[model samples]
Target: MDEQRKKGLEKMNEVYGWEMPNIEGDPYFDLTVDHLFGSIWTRPGLSMRDKRLLTLAAVTAQGRQDLGEVQVNAALFNEEFTEEELKEVAIFLTQYVGFPLGSGLNGTVSKVVAKRRKAAEKGAGEDKRANVNAAVKMNTGTSLDDE
Candidate 1:
């Protein structure tokens, strides 16, 4: 793999807390890995947590609960935001984005939190990465190609 793609995959894996394979020959995936993630997300100024908050707000404003779930799962898995903090984010965004959109986000946050709690309780010794990968896959589908 090229250096930029390799760097992007590494960054993407770090951000999502999972191993993401490179999807060669797909323009969308190429742009995502080589540009969006490689260039934009790797930029120095904003922390991943800060970028996540911005992403959550943007997706929530669009009422994209499906996307919100992915973000919430990754954020929680990465320990960038606590469950309580996510709840607060839902409440905070509700004011500016309106009740419906906010409620959608709230629901997504609650669902992810509950799932993580269940996983933890179910297998105290289980690998946390497995649970997170499962959650991310469930929310995002098998791959970008599937979308």
Candidate 2:
């Protein structure tokens, strides 16, 4: 198993207080997570904004707001999408996903934005107090939340 998948499963287990039964019995497990998200998502062609928009649509259509919220945070905080960009994605989602989903999307986006911005400011203050020179060199090229 890839460490990424292992770590994801670990987190799930920790949260739910039980290991999610392995879906390896189903052959699509590896292909879905590994080939799709792991490989295709990491490719350079799609911008993070596009990915987040896609994720928002998919999650809303499928009624998976928890996952969507995480992706929203990844896009806004980790991928450095501006507030306008995030709003655009949420607005666009309404066309295919409907108004109710759009409202949930708005709430999810707002919640993540507030939480992440506060966390970032706190981290910055902590870094400043610690005199961590590396904090000054922000690597904005990629998502930092996953690692």
Candidate 3:
């Protein structure tokens, strides 16, 4: 990756708590990262959570649900806003933004939340299995590292 894009991706990952998607091959990724993220998103004035929320409202207002998905998922993964807080934002925004747009945003948020919850459950199951294996090993008198 180019230095600017790399820096932008790094900063985005730091803020979003997950790796950004397809930035390497995306043609417009540079514009978004270099201009949008590098210049605007990296600003110190607004916290990332605030930025995410603002972006959420702006994108949702424009009916850009496709783009909104990334912002929505990132907001959840970053733990910047609770689902309830997002719902409240939806309520207030709908007063100005219209019900259809708000409803679309709500659907997008629900999908992202469900996806994250499923992933968490899967990870928890894997952790449970690991702990059980460890316990069995301990009961049989050998540490996992011993063999």
Candidate 2 overall lDDT versus native? 0.56
Give candidate 2 regions above 4 Å deviation: 1-33, 43-45, 124-147
Instruction: Report the lDDT tens digits of candidate 2 across residue range 1-147.
Output: 767666545443332223343345334544444454455656688775566567678887777777666566556544557767777777887887888887787788888777757868887421221111211112122122322
Worst 10 residues of 2 by lDDT: 130-139
Best by TM-score: 1
Give lDDT: candidate 2, residue 17.
Answer: 27
Q: Give the Cα-based TM-score of candidate 3 against the true structure.
A: 0.72
lDDT agreement with native, every candidate: 0.83, 0.56, 0.68
Q: What is the TM-score of each candidate against the true structure?
A: 0.85, 0.55, 0.72
Ranking by TM-score, best first? 1, 3, 2
lDDT of 3 by residue, 1-147 (tens): 667777777785665555454234334555666776667788888888788888888988998786676667667666788888887877788887899999888888887778768868887522333333343243344444564
Candidate 1 pairs with clashing backbones: none
Q: Which window of 10 residues has the lowest lDDT sum in candidate 1?
A: 136-145
Residue 130 in model 2: lDDT: 18
lDDT of the structure predicted as candidate 3: 0.68
